[model samples]
Target: MSFTQQLHQAAQNIWQKSLVHPFITELQSGQLPLTKFRFYLLQDRYYLVEFSKFHHLLAEQAGNPQIKKFLLQSEADLRACEWSVRSDFFTGLKITPMEIRQTAVAPTAYNYVNHMYLTLERDGFAPAIAAIVPCYWLYQEIGQKLAKVGSPVALYQTWIDTYDSDWYEVNVTHILQLINILASQATATDRQMMQTAFIRSSYYELQFWQMAYAKERW
Candidate 1:
């Protein structure tokens, strides 16, 4: 199979077999409670700034022009999300920026993302792309599912809005296309290495979410 097909298949497997489906089911069932949801939003609000910085660095180092452009675009999207969350905090929740900053972050979860960025910077763009694939793929999948269900939940809207934002979608598509192009130019060893990195990154992505959910619950 082509690299795109392989990556898509891997993502499909993750969606079906992993915690993502269960988490979405929980959201659909309204089991997370408003308090937990609010906490999650606040936590993510702070993290987006760091995440955006990481992506900005990655985009600068990306070998493919298209991928670099997409990364730059994603930085903008992350910033917008950060702004939205901050606005909601002050106006909607009456929370202060200091409170948001002082909120306890899940170290393991944040570290994993940081590690991915470091890996990308150290290992090379192909592996970095591989490492980050799960986030993009998972977001795309979740967005599509939520959009299909047409749910009215605020959390659903949040997820869909953030993941399905034009910038996110464009980056996802660009990354997939770049992977295909790179795959064609790669040797068998390179392909295997990239695939291995991609799969490991996906697992880390799963862990990141699981850790975030667990930390917020605490």
Candidate 2:
């Protein structure tokens, strides 16, 4: 399969295994709670910062000029998310910056993202991109679903606000563009390696979310 096709397929697999099949049933029933929604928002806020940091490292290491630019743009996008979370916290919504920061660095998801970055920084850009794809694609898919589900449904609005924002969309587009460029530069063997890494990373992403949601158990 072409690189884009492979990426899409991997993403579809993740959605099927993680969000679409699992949450769609609950969401369709409109039975998910506000506390759970809040927990998701808080969890996401913590995660995005780590993502931004990882992209910053990638931007610095990127051999391809286009990929470099995309990484830089992604950093900006992450910052915008940070700002939005702060806004949400300051609005008297019971959200706090410390809580977000603490959760971001929590042992489970935080450590996983950190390990992915370390692997990428140590291994190569291809591996790093592979490690990162699940986070990007999964967030996009979830955001789209939440958007369909509408607001005040327990974390739906906060999620919509974060994931559907211009900053988030731009980052997603840039990552896809970077992947396309990377695929073009890679030989068949390298492309295969990237594909494997992408699949593994995507699975890890699902695991992280599942773990986080389970831990919160709202």
Candidate 3:
């Protein structure tokens, strides 16, 4: 199998579990308590900000114009997404910036974001990209799947729409193309590292949802 295919296979179990996770199932049914989602949205900011940082760091290291452009775009998109989460979404709910600032990061969210930082800082592009791809691909997978289920809640519906937008395919295609290019040039050892990074990140994806489900704190 191609490396991307292999990566998908490696993460397949995690993806399946994530799809049926209590948090996701509740989200799809629009039965998730608002308090849980509130805490989740508040805590997610911690992850998104760090995610933007990793993209900016990658953009700095990118030599290829396309890679650089994509990384910069990714960073910009993440920042905008964060703003939407904090401003448009939260403001609609009357959550002030001060409130968000006061919200503590959940332990799993902290670990996941920190994992991205360490993986990108310590690894080459192949493994670094592998480490981050799950966040993009997994959310897209969950979002699109949830989009197919009609939710009574507007917030739940809009959240699904945002993540399931058509642009996700374009971004996924571009990133997969980049991954194929990187994989072609990678040594077996590098490939193994990439696989390891993918698995670890995928595991964290599962934990993140579980955290949201449990409304974990500290």
Q: In lDDT terms, which candidate is top?
A: 3
Residues 28-134, model 3: lDDT tens digits: 89889888888778777778878788888888888789889998997887676645655667877777879878788889999988877787767777788888888
Candidate models: Cα lDDT each: 0.66, 0.66, 0.82
Could you give candidate 1's per-residue lDDT for residues 152-184 as a string of tens digits?
676456656666567667768877877788788
Candidate No. with top TM-score: 3
Error of 2 at 52 (Å): 1.2
The residue-by-residue lDDT of candidate 2 on 141-177, one tens digit each, is 7777767756554444564556666767777776777
For model 2, state the Cα shift of residue 189 in Å. Answer: 3.1
Go through the candidates in order and give the clash count of each.
0, 2, 0
- Name the runs in model 3 displaced over 4 angstroms: none
Which candidate would rank higher by TM-score, 1 or 2? 1
Q: Give the distance in Å from residue 9's predicted Cα in candidate 2 to where it truly belongs.
A: 1.6
